[model samples]
Target: MFDKFLSIDEEKRQRVINAALKVFAQKGYQAASTNEIAREAGISKGLLFHYFTSKKDLYLYLYDYAVKLITETIEQFVDPEERDYFERLKQIAQVKLSVLNDHPDLLGFQKTIFFEDSAEVSAELKARSKEIAETAYYRLFADIDKSKFRPDIDADRAINVILWALEGMGEAERARHRALGIDLDIPYMMEEFDRYLELFKTSFYK
Candidate 1:
């Protein structure tokens, strides 16, 4: 019953969703109120409920929507002609990084939701997220040729390894800073991103 908003035009609905993202990210799910989201969107509180039944419903919808948004953003640059693993991997990484760059709120909203997750929260969101993730995994791996990856490398393991590396880049840098009590000397993130893609290319495809 809780389908993601596929038919809705983002241009029309984004005012609300984008506003809700900020409210939810800042206040967290428990503390965030619909009035706050409505105020942020400059809409009447009465109108907010017209779009969604409750804060939980809206957050769940946004969570599902986020998974789709992320994949669709990545799909735009995944050219079939760019079959070289490095070329393909670079494009994919660019896609992911660009999505994060443009929609930075998703990271915080997601962190809050994941931290607050429980059986009391919507199970549909959890199931849908898993389904979306599995589909993304299949789509990504389908683009790769088994012969290109290291013969000893487990396909699933390799995918998880790369995914974790992407997640760790910023956090690892922050951790280093905190441990030493010094400023970050991290190079340009995009350049690090480029270097990472090259590493995957050289290690796996070359």
Candidate 2:
């Protein structure tokens, strides 16, 4: 579907992707302008549309591209032999930090999609997001060593609880920063995340 876009030189393709990511992350699907994206990419709107048939198509393509890139990066960096659950989660978070260091706008674009409410792409986004989440949960957690967990507790349910709690903590922190009209403090966020992981480890580990 994106053969034409893929055929472009890497630098030009990245420019387009970065421009679209910035526009969509900021203005979201409903209000983001293709003209703005084109201008940022140093291309005409006609050329942008030539690569992507429509705005919706471009937005969805960006989402898929971002997910694939991030997923691959995580798989590459995270140690598969680390069977401890909390340690695995910590490694995944560190991999994300590395990805953000390289592609600053990618995380913001993904967060925007997570909270996207635009009628134009919300349904499709929701379905894709659900599928991605399930696949990620299975891939990341399914192989973790169960023996580290408390013997009396169900490790599966305990893992679910820990995931939900950490997710809620992340959402709350994002909301707090959004309310303050400031960019996220990644270092501080990581520190807090580590603290939460320690707490969870104390509770769940034998």
Candidate 3:
């Protein structure tokens, strides 16, 4: 289905994807209008269908593309030698932010997709969400050096707590930004992550 899309100029292909992403992020699969997407991409509705047969197909295609993009980005920038859990996480966040620079709607759209209640896409999203949860976080900490943690501390528990804190902080940041009608600044958020991680290390490190 994407063969025709692939044959197009790279910039044009991305324009379509970005246009679809913006609409999907705001309206989700059930309510997103292909007419709106085509207009946003500066193409006709007929051309959009020529590229993607249906709204469902477009949503799934974009979902797969976004997931692959982020997974590849993380794999490239997250170093295996960075055994410090917090440092590795910081590196991962930075790389994710870099990706967000080009694909502004990706992260938010993904978050929405995972929790999307539409029956049309719920099963697929649930499966992908499970697959990601099983592989991603487990791999990140699989070879972490536990000795750096205090001898009295439970290493796994400490790692879990840190992960929870980071996730909470991210959600809070998104919520705050939404409430204030401000755009998310990746560097600003990274700085906040650094401050929290440093304080956490002071308390937890040997």
Candidate 4:
């Protein structure tokens, strides 16, 4: 499914990333193998090694790509600029759910890092992931002036709320998928999200 991602240049790097994303997204970090990734990429195993020295290397490469994709999704599209900041927060929640829908296995891969008792994940990957997340959070936080929000609202606490919302939304969806043995019905999810966001708007916004 991810062939043609092994193109031979910088452009191809993005292709490799997409290919890696597909593989890692499907098999996850611990179970994913370099040979399998290479086969999926339509490249020889030796060529895959030439591009990424080890399974860990390919994983970190894809992890960086994922961070950029998630961060950029928030920074650019989550809250359209013409909207109120708190309303934009609702948009952020919706956009987060959309991203999770497109990449359902992402939560599983992410959970592996926090819950795994093994050493499949590298320390560097975790640190870099944290760095990207913090930068994105600060960027989103800067979008709104604290004074403009509810008098009782705390900016740092709000940031924590955002983190909780994003992660929890994904976790909840993953749990539902496991329990039901089917993909999440995202249209219904968005409908419920809009209902709650409206409630938040009514109570929390001036």
For model 1, name the residue pairs that clash: none
Query: In model 3, how large is the Cα lDDT of residue 18?
Result: 91
Error of 2 at 43 (Å): 2.8
Error of 2 at 77 (Å): 1.1
How high is the CA lDDT of each candidate model? Answer: 0.70, 0.86, 0.82, 0.64
Ranking by TM-score: 2, 3, 4, 1
lDDT of 4 by residue, 1-206 (tens): 12333445766675566567666666667777777777766778888787677778777666666666776787777644634656666677667667766775554444444333236566776577568667775667564655655788775675567556756765676677667867456577677667656665665556
Tell me the tens digit of each residue's lDDT in model 1 across 42-113.
Answer: 788887777777777888878877777877877776787665555666787677667766776776676566
| Model 4 global lDDT (CA atoms, 0 to 1) | 0.64
Error of 4 at 182 (Å): 3.1
- Candidate 1, lDDT over the whole model: 0.70
Model 2: runs farther than 4 Å from truth?
7-9, 25-31
lDDT by residue (tens digit), candidate 3, 98-179: 7867775886676466446688888877687567667875776788788899999998888778877876887788688767
lDDT of 1 at 13: 75
Number of clashes recorded per candidate:
0, 0, 0, 0
- Per-residue alpha-carbon lDDT of candidate 2 for residues 16-89, written as tens digits (9 for 90 to 100): 99999998878878789999999999999999999999999999999889878888889888898999998998
Output the number of the lDDT-best candidate: 2
